[model samples]
Target: MMRRFEDARILMYSHDTFGLGHLRRCRTIAHSLVEDYRGLNILIISGATIAGAFDYRARVDFVKIPSVIKLRNGEYTSLEKHIDLHETLKMRQSIIRHTAETFEPDIFIVDKEPMGLRGEVEETLAYLKTRGTTLVLGLREVMDAPHLLDAEWKRNDVMRKIGQYYDRIWVYGPPDFYDPLVGLDVPPAVRSKMDFVGFLQRSVSHDHGDDHRPSGDYILVTTGGGGDGAELIHDVIHAYQQDPTLTHRALMVLGPYMPAKQRRKLVRKGSKIPYIEVIEFDNRMEELIAGAKAVVAMGGYNTYCEILSFDKPALIVPRIVPRQEQLIRAQRAAELGLIDMLLPEESADPLRFAAALKALPSRNPPSVNAKGLRLEGLPNISRIVGDWIDGRGGKEPLRVIKR
Candidate 1:
């Protein structure tokens, strides 16, 4: 199809308080949308401190908001020590509203958090709703444990707000994988708006511009954003140390948010292992994943998508604290034979982890095990956006998938 809608605008929100997962997912979606349509421009509002480290496509850009960090205990505070949390939230809310007012987007896509971090985007959502914008709520394939998720949402009237503001809710996974809103009091009105769009596929950039990208056979170990990744990284290193027979070359990306002391400690330890290579961070993770023989990760949403996108053998060591989202995803994928999983406790057993790591490369890839797997989210989303812009949208009824 020829490029159309030269003046169309899209605004995306990624309340990136904890990890790189949110920003990376939004970036991939934004890039895919622009490629699908000509003359379309997308602006992402991100709270990640390293949002600008990423490369954006021609028509996609981002606005960085004041950073607020979400601690492991589920409390929020300003990333800057001197700034008050309330003050930071106020600034973020103000900037988000101002950007929406100026950008005047035809569509507003909010990632995960309905009201955004601490309801910072509530005003923006309301303003956009008044302007007749197509408001969308994008959710990961799996959310936290249903009970935990329910309590969190119950604290605020999140379900009500989502029903009121969003015209559509896109689950970035297939219907068979998981339902993000399971065990919640979802009204029929809100349930009808859901579209199970499958997983967002990833691809290496056209330019192999990064000289640091790995070459040859190696297991890629990553903790997305490295905020809470120290344990996983340590476990991997311990596995290498425990068994000298595990000689597969490993490249570990410590992630950007990892504390410097822990990063330094891990780097120092991993360096002593002949087959282990540690890099602080790399923005072009897709390229590295593509080059790897297998993958070891904490099973964040973005990494899982990339593992499937690249069809690499994967071992998922999912985090269970603060949120069980990753653990849920890992367990489900394991059940489907898409990937292998180890609890944090299991991974700490160096011998057990080393054995898992050694066996990783030969394990069958996701494509072979999960014939029903899908990675059509990007294209489907593009089509949906086009339909909405081209006068073809109303809540076209879709099956309200249940757990």
Candidate 2:
């Protein structure tokens, strides 16, 4: 068992190289923790290029790691320097370890990846294990399908690592809909450390007033990161072109990482439709989401949480390559009646896309009342982490406070 320390000095590691999911998740959890425990101090370690864009609370701080790019060939390379992929990954891992050692955090919460920054976290995890510091693994509710996850989990030795090092395995999604650890071959002893923490969502106080001139009820098109979103964006544009009566305006936000040539092509195509507006990137995405009548989006974890929290009707087009996590999330959300998902084959069909878009209601459907979704666990996560430091364990009841 990991040794417990008293009080709060927490370090959260989020390896968000391209998109906002990991960073956003860390931020949400940190915000909840600080609000629940006024004495807590949080230091977020993220690799996002746009980390500065977010507004954080007083007790929270950030460390920006060098950015990396996901190439068309499904490979990743460092963006800031011309280094071998192996070398880049090694360098990043070294920095992550150094930061952890120097900071000496009482509790370390690692998001998704077990090894961290290409296994750099292994060094820190080893050091923390020797020092008897608490270590927790934070996982999203849905990872991928059983078979794929089984293969990847074994290959990465994630189960072994979790069983060996982690004191707690906190799942950010409910167990009823999906258990992230299923099929991972976790032993019963290690499984005892698992806790389902419910979905972590950004809480926006009051709707940011809908100021932008409605734009005649247009469909908002967004790909979390346009790296793999080219096909989806093209399909949406084609769908719009095929049906002249579709009548709705189209606002496409090409993610910052999309290739320039591809973006230019989309811009030229969008020009053909007087009602379609193509923007390279916009910081005010939440504003755009709020202004839209319906949303057409990729099924990234962060996007799923936003759609649920905003309570908007959405058509999720998930990416199935590199990882099947998005597809699983979209399918699960659809099954729960939280949102609509377009199958990979149907995503390209103009009629099918249009029909799905047209079928979406303007509001979210009512949800089933359940213990898991009470959002009672958010504050509890904070309390548990704090109490864990103070030598507490097992399940504890959570209290909710309105801000």
Candidate 3:
């Protein structure tokens, strides 16, 4: 039997360390939950560098964990403290377990990662399962391709783990376009627990407010985390330099983790351009994107959602290595006529990059058959979550209008 939303206490976990995507998505969902269930009390477990920047309702609270980052060599390390990786992970696990035990939430929502911060959630899930707490895994719309996903699943035993432990799997994207579980060989029983809740993105209000807009036509270049974005940034600068006639000014946001030396070099180089502005980081990305004519961004899920939500023409350069998830998302979005994708090989040529940017205006804006593709998923997702809590089966699939 489902519990009641207004009277329920929810525990949400988002282990965001490198970039703002996970943290932002989790916050959006939490906000939606609060809006739908007026009296909902949400406790967010996040490790984002910018957690304190968000303003939450009185019923919402957060536990900020130690931040961590993924190294180029595929290793995870702490961002703030210089502790050993193993020790840091262990400490994180302890905190997660302690939080779950103390709070005694009715439902537990784990975002992106199933094992939580370095497999921390595993301990919590075990404890919760024994204590009769509902466990749900919230996955982004797109994961990597079949081969990569298979390898990852096998290595992590994600399929088996989910089958045994989770009560529900909520995908934040439409299955009609891309079903994340398509080729995974999941059991029928496990599949029954899956729900495609559409894309969970923050809604854009008509009142964009008085955010500073660039004087002339300018391209916004951003990588959620500057760690893997240096190459993309370099290529954009090179592309602009190659063609002096590139009319648009460039605004590059070297994300928080971008090394000081690298940032200084980019700043110096951008100063020479006379048409470029560089900032270390800006929390108000939605406003910045709203004001831009076009966007050149790394193909992270959150950024893709933002571009679609704003109806802005975009040229996405998805990172290939480490995880092909971003590349897969870019390709899918391009296939759907939503955005343009420029692969790494194509981005190697300055002319190619220039051409992609120049052709942005021709691409069609994102559209849905229902409600005109206005990004209605946040509210609907919240409603469904509330219904489930209210002891409503929530068996019906949320309707989504495809373009």
Candidate 4:
């Protein structure tokens, strides 16, 4: 009974509390969905300060809510000092509910946060559930240290709420790669709703990399969103200062959120190093990563995907504070021989970091056996969505390359 289902609307929510990771991930999926289904329209409700900075497709649009920022100590506050956190949360909740009512999305997808930043989206989820709109929860391949996540959820009864509201739970990675809920006491029902869609792959539209890419092979160092990235950048610069023989030209991107003072110091110091180049921010990260000989990054989910998609050798310096999501991911990926990892303390050692950078360019890129690595999230999502819309109910995922 599959119909010709040509037209549909999908609404996505991204509570970008910290960096651009949530918003970027949503945008990537939104673009892919629209590209696959010509008649589909996607509306993303985002809390990113620079939500308007990136481009969107013809049918892809976004609604910007008041931005909220997360501090290193794991607390959230209004992005604007003048606005009270309580009032901002109220405004965000109201805006989300109103948008959901107006959009009437066939599918409602919430990224990461189960209850949406202090349970702001709880009411919307209930409303959508009553309306019979397909409610989906999208999660990163790695969440956080299990105990930390478990305690946080237990305090709010988030696991129970997820089961009650969501019809499906999409973990954006292959099941074998990692289980986001491994240590949690997830009920059988919630477990059954889980779908391991593999990693979301990245692609560059065109090769505009000539401008930034080095003539000879170089390492591209990037910290997604750059709020907690100053430490990594400082380490890299110090490594170069310590090792005069490290000749590989390094291109570093200071993400938009990095403090102005830190950025200036890094720029001034990096300028003295003939082989190092520092840029403020570039939306074309895929291009830079693709063109590089290797990558040095803080290993955010998006950066991890980019590393695999581009098949570049990478050195991941995963952060351990606030949340251990990056550390956990880096550890797993390193264990699987997908990437090399260094702890923050280890990476801070100028000599150790310099040696890693020197070896990075010549190291082998990611290569695995048939059951090794897969990037099938986008295609599978499109297929399942198409099936749902056409009344075909395609629950199974499409296969990836055998290599």
Candidate 5:
């Protein structure tokens, strides 16, 4: 039975490792919850350096833990601090547990990471369970390759934790498109609690980036976080350099995590080209996407969501490194005729990239007949949360919109 309370609180954990996807998704949910409920409070625990970049809603604030970044070789390190990995994880664990005990939220949302980084949230989850706080595990639509994910989860015992800790498993995507847990052999009990909330719809805002907004119909190229996007950036620039007559103007947002030396080189090369604009970072990415003719990007979750939401024709060059999540998503989307894809191995050739860029303007967006496509994740999440708070067990049916 749901309780009737005028005021409620939510505490969400986002294990920020590579990009801003986790933090951005949580912030969107936080904003939605605060807007719907009168006296709701949402607290996000994140490690994103750019958490302060966006303007969060009232009653939605974040606690920034010491930032830790994942490197190319699958090792972890503190982003900008002198602290060691062990020390940083310990500190983060302490902060997370302390916040949960003090906040005493009615609901707890864990993003992506099952037990948090290095199992930091286990103790916290145990503590919250004892208090009867509603626990939710939120996952992206598609994780990584089934084999890879299965092994990783097995090592971490994620399946066991899912059964023991989570009250509900919220997959932030429609099941008709892709099931993030498909190959993991999810137990029936946990599967029954899974909610296929539609993809969160991103609002278009011109409130930001007016001064630096690119003029004219240009192709926008971006790599979420730019940590491993240096190759993508170079490829786009090479495409422009190779095909000088390619009339499409290009604007590239090299993510902030891009290496300084590499960024300098990108800027220097772009300076010679009148039609290309290179920026280090911009918080108003949606507005930029809104103004673009088409998109060329890596297949990060947030970027892909924004691309689909805006209905922009996109050519994805997904990474196949530490995780195949992006590559898997891009391949699936391609199969569904949603976006164009250039495999990582194929992206090395300048001519192939140039050809793809030239063809982007004319390629049609995803076919309207695409099945089970749901992009209204924000309002759906709000409604589900509202039901939970109102003690109404009934859920809103998944909203499926044609692509």
Candidate 6:
């Protein structure tokens, strides 16, 4: 843990179970750190199979472990490798432990999962704690509902690990919008270490460069990773199919993880509609979003950030089963006038989607009220990390600022 300020090393763990949120969030943080602090090295340990597809900045790198996906039954399975869940988790556990010991980073930031998948990061957390590493846990603005989150955390013994191993907990969103730990019976001990660092603002550069921009006005529809988004995609496409008189052109990015056959089926369906275009994936999604007349998406953390970053008017169709995190976020944001959302039942009806689509052109942009929301989380995170480097962290609670 002892190191020259200029030589400080940061290691982040992102358990990318089913989506790109964790990896993208960590990458933004890692890039911000190294960019702000000269010679600060950051290494991310991720389970993202598409890790190489991203463009990482200088001084930021990653170690990709075997991937896993969370199933609808609340169990994890190997993403691609033939091994069973137990073997996959064991392999991941070993890789994490070895990386922590060998990397010996001054600051260790664990993304979302306190103990990682199946507690794979337990050994690493324990190891780094004994070494006096500056340990932190990065969280999204909203986890699931309070009762669900409390029960799950309790079952997983998350609070204890948080109390024992982490020096600080950074919630990457504004408290004014949502208090992530509220109603979870977060002990005073853990609460004291919590900081609402505001939302991590994504760069507009990722929105799109000239080359990737769409040639014509279009409504951009995307499901973060496209695995569980089949229903949403289907509804949207069906809406377009049912409403031939729809004026706006739509470009759909079927997430890479969507079953190939399903993607092909969607592609075929889209081919019949002149107004609809379908693609597999785009690393530069922000570009597409930036150029869109309006945005339609699932309510993943990263997607929300991108939508807010561009201040686009968005129609959020969030998933409800398996996890309610996205639905919770979408609902809250809608209530706050940051975006609009269709209920599960409503999104399932093509007629309703068609109705929503027809009104998209007249909808107000999120920027109308997004001005009051905090989007400086990336810079604030860098400041907080700098404070830690200077031994000045934990001196003050990051208060909620009402914008």
Error of 3 at 259 (Å): 2.4
TM-score of each candidate? 0.97, 0.87, 0.89, 0.95, 0.93, 0.94
Candidate 2, 1-403: lDDT as tens digits: 2323334678899887667778878988887777767767789988888788877887899988777776656567888677777777777777777888888877889998887755768888888777766888888888777788788678878788888888877887666768876666778867777788766655553333645434467778889767777888888888778877666677888887687899889989988988788888765566577666778898787676666555567889888877778888888777777778887789889988876766665546324322235443465586677666565332232322211
lDDT of 3 by residue, 136-234 (tens): 898887777778777877888888888888887888887665777666787887777787777766554334465455576667899876877888888
Angstrom error at residue 242, model 6: 1.3
Question: What's the lDDT of the predicted structure labeled candidate 5?
Answer: 0.84
Better of 3 and 6 by TM-score: 6
Error of 3 at 362 (Å): 5.4
> Which residue runs of candidate 3 sit more than 4 Å off their true CA positions?
1-7, 204-217, 368-374, 392-403
lDDT of 5 by residue, 1-403 (tens): 2223476899999988888889988988887777677688899999998888878777899999989898898788887567788999999999999999999988899999989988999999999998888888988988889999999999988898899988888888877778888777888877877888778877664344545456678889999889899898888777778887776888899998888999999899888888788989988788788778899999788888888888889999999988888988999999999999999778778788888889998888654535647686777777667777777333332333212
Question: Candidate 5 has which clashing residue pairs, if any?
Answer: 199-377
- Candidate 4 overall lDDT versus native: 0.88
Residues 238-317 of candidate 4 have per-residue lDDT tens digits of 99999999889999998998889999999999999999999988887887898999999999999999999999999999
lDDT of candidates 1 onward, in order:
0.90, 0.74, 0.76, 0.88, 0.84, 0.84
In order of TM-score, best first, we have: 1, 4, 6, 5, 3, 2
The lowest-lDDT stretch of 10 consecutive residues in candidate 4 is 394-403
TM-score of 3: 0.89
All-Cα superposition RMSD per candidate: 1.8, 4.7, 3.5, 3.0, 3.3, 2.9
Model 1 lDDT at residue 112 = 95
Q: How many collisions between residues are there in candidate 5?
A: 1
Error of 4 at 48 (Å): 1.0
Best candidate, lDDT-wise? Answer: 1
Superposition TM-score, candidate 2 onto the true structure:
0.87
Model 2: ten consecutive residues of lowest lDDT: 394-403
Q: Model 4: clashing residue pairs? A: 173-198
